[model samples]
Target: MTVVHVLLGLGWWLVAPRGAQGVPRPFLSLHPSREVTLGDTVTLRCRVPHPNVPVSIYEEDGEPKWQWDRVEDTAEVSVNVVTRDFAGRYRCQYNMTALSRFLRVSNPVELVVLDPNFPPPVMSLSPGGRVKPGTDVTVSCWSTYGATFLLHKAGISAPIQRQSLSRGNTATFTLYGVTQSDVGTYGCSYHPRGNPFVSSHPRSEVTLELEEGGPSMDHPVSQQPAPRPSLSLHPSEEVALGDNVTFRCHVPRKGVRVIVYKEGDGNYRWQQDGVQDTTEVSMQASTNEISGRYRCRYEILAPTWATDWSDPVEMVVLDASFPPPTLSLSPRGHVETGTNVTICCRSPHGATFVLYKAGTSDPIQRIVTGNTVAFTLHGVTQADTGTYGCSYRPQENPFISSPIGTSMTIPWHRDTFP
Candidate 1:
């Protein structure tokens, strides 16, 4: 016997169990679908395999929230006033006496409720400047209140990414190996932590654009110095052991041969002759020994002229075995402008320490060697007020580094003194 059902605008054909020849699997459907606004009506209907069976609908908790007995094969429970508590997982099950009193349960469905009054989260893009192909970018959603973040791309009905945070008010989504297809407008909506169904308003959109070809300079092509090639790391310059990393070298012209060099080693790490202006080399960082500084140069195939090497880029593989560094800020509470403040990082082992400011990609300052590094801020201003973190690499283990430490915030005042 064949049983066909349609729910939520989609159709499905139900199949019977092998031993129970004519008993089709029980199914559940929702009226008004999974997501609904507050005060909306929703109905949960369960279609059982047998007629005149007892059906019960339950939430995530074991206790049944609703139950009904019907002579037909279907049982339904309706909610006239949908509240935040109604937003959760719901499933239905039925007991059939003909089948040895066995109970069969339907698949669970998620219910989301939107709150029209909640304000939207603010969305921002990382590498806020220019984005080029073969690079990774992060999109952040931040709100004053803690919530679950839903990242949405324009023209897509459902969210592309979802992140729930129990403590923080911010969520970040990273787009790896970005290409031309990644260029689009994105926004974010959030559901407050305790009330998962209460979605906030959508944030303003952020448009992403990729650099098409070679970079442009204001100076004339004839008067300027020979254009140098540029090198970039995809995903990130920093990575974990066993993670795959890609190195991209972009030249001013296509059909050129590119060579990437490793610092301190006379031998070139990789070389490629390609028709496209941008070429990429991918490898897995199996060991911390792979961490090092690198540069790339390009040679015009026809003219046989080699361009100067691009700026050095370092890859740091994080070693979780090392303890995370610690960050501290002086002038305990709030400091007035024009005041000198000290920020310090303490590590278990002496090495290279770096300081990072929140919301920015690159490190603000780095010390070549130290167990405890103190960074002094001269005449601190409003611009210096933000959260800061630190991390360090052991001198003996140059290739591996500790994870980022806890962050400390420094607030600055205009002029509190007379």
Candidate 2:
């Protein structure tokens, strides 16, 4: 009796044959291996060596899958389209006929079928996609860029494999094994690192079919060209202070993920769901961050693909006066009568500056300059001992002004007769 069993772990487990070294066994094998995605065409090759014999293929003992009469050497079984039910361990045998003295049974090979609810990833085999039984096989998963990845196989609940992302600007994962458990559909997905909740909308799927009898096989990852998404500010060019504004991202096609960006030193991001064609994001133009350049891009889930950044859409924020104008008096302490007291106002981004006295709606004076503005009260007197304030209009925008910068004053009385 041949000893065959396995130790289970993260990798797939399969029963190994006990055939002696240098001993040849008529074991089942697959060509290009049977791993296939849903809707893919696959061919399972069965090899029956010389002396002219009939061959029989089965899913397991006493469960025949197919048979061939007096076949020469090789037989090809074609699966038009793969489905989940097609997944199983298969074996092939030969010569139950009178022309041959012995009936030989081959080892089993699992036909693992995978169907992707999302998009399937391109798989590649290292050192080649095929390997003999007992030898290691490397199944590398490749796509544009994905963060964390997961590997799945037929009938298993939890992920059969997991791989963290590698930097150097690459999104690939590698699974190592050559066992029956490894035979099935394999898929992966990615999200921005640190974000475990939101994964890419589409998954990357791959199916790896194991060969029966002799060796094993796998494939190399595939790469595709990335797409580019366009972005714009609604009301395109500029936004007014305190006005409702929007940032819209547009992709060439629908069903893709679009990310909108504003140049921020430290910005937390937001996501929008069910994006049909364009992503519309709106916010009030209240902060200094309102005006600047913005752009957009997109990503494809299944393919693990991304597009280049769209052309930048510059935004001009109207009136960005938060830390309002600074109002200062030259004779800051106590102003003596018959001396000039200069009130100066300045704000980094303000376009116009105005000086206002308390209890008056009319500005004492207004100046048109993005820089400093000064108004001098000549020969300060008791009448000019009122509160003074300064304000500014930013970027020449309508209805946008800085908060009032107020200054208190008390003029020292200089008596004509002491």
Candidate 3:
């Protein structure tokens, strides 16, 4: 019986036809590799040596695992619009009775479905008009098509707030602490996975104005007679160099000849003179020596009596050549994983400063310092390690300095000593 069993085993190995060898050919091929969007389809087919053999189709890593075996001459499988999870490689094999053979592994067909939607949703501020400073305002965003909306504020680059889809075709954004600087345009858009191919138009703009004390509309009219005769310097107020300074005065509306005088010891330096009813003049001062209080007055022709000088507006000019501000990292040295740190900037003169991570195009943070000139980071992490610097523009034209300061690296992990 042992000899007979040995003979049978030998027969099985020798007589059973060898499994198909070499590379099997693919009938159809997909060009790109895997990574398709949420709504795409793909097809795969295998080449058959002889026509009319049962060919079964199967998909690896697909939901529901396997589809019913397709017994056509050439097997073809189709995947409908895909989602994030649908990204993967797929191949087919031919099943032979003796042994199964793999056809050429089709080139990884990658499908990337973009949002396809351009220009996001439209957002409108209601009353659909401008809001007065310090007043509450409501912003609304609506999509002609899908839901899901993101709202971005003017001046603020990032999306300050977001809203989920509600019943109707619209979503509303509201601002309680509205200010005059927030008086620009706003935008909104939608992000949808399904049919992610549509976007809405941007809505109109809204303007906001600031009113000191109470609304400027409520101020009582001045009863005293206007007085302005001679030009004199107002008390000089100190100002950082590179800052925009405006000189203002009150001149009679009609029949008044106005001449601006810069206060200088002994002889008053006369500057430009004009007949137009001008109240304010602006100029960039280069140094502290140019600083002084300035006042203005007007006369009607030679013999006419000049009015009392208007209130003096002080101006003080500081040095303009200081180096650009420096950015400093708190807790100096390596940053441990998950540890927090602060990045601070100190500049004598700058309107706005933006902080960017090395190699990145967008700013990590931005600070608009009308008066205060510093940027503070709340929490620092390992990712915060890199070069840092800033660019600044003086109040007026001429030159905007190049980026100032050097770069610093922060390491997240520390080496342990044995």
Indicate the TM-score of model 2: 0.27
Give the per-residue lDDT of model 2 (tens digit) for 83-146. 4556555667665343222345466666544445434345655545444333445556554544
Over the stretch 319-344, how does candidate 1's per-residue lDDT look in tens digits? 77788866666766656654666766
Off by over 4 Å in 2: 1-23, 96-101, 118-418
Q: Per-residue lDDT of 1-418 in model 3, one digit per residue for the tens? A: 0000001112222222243344354443442323233465655555555444445433322312332243446665666754444433344444433332222222223233333333455556665454445464677766666454655556544344444443566766654434433444566666442322222334234454444543334222112324544332223243556566655555556655664444222132333445665545565555544454345556444333334334544453534364556656566654443334555565566544555554544444444444234433322222233455554533331123323455555443332100
lDDT of each: 0.64, 0.52, 0.43
For candidate 3, which ten residues in a row score worst on lDDT? 1-10
Q: How should the candidates be ordered by TM-score, best one leading?
A: 1, 2, 3
Clash counts for all predictions? 1, 22, 21
Worst 10-residue stretch by lDDT in candidate 1? 1-10
lDDT of 2: 0.52
Candidate 3's C-alpha runs over 4 A off are: 1-120, 193-418
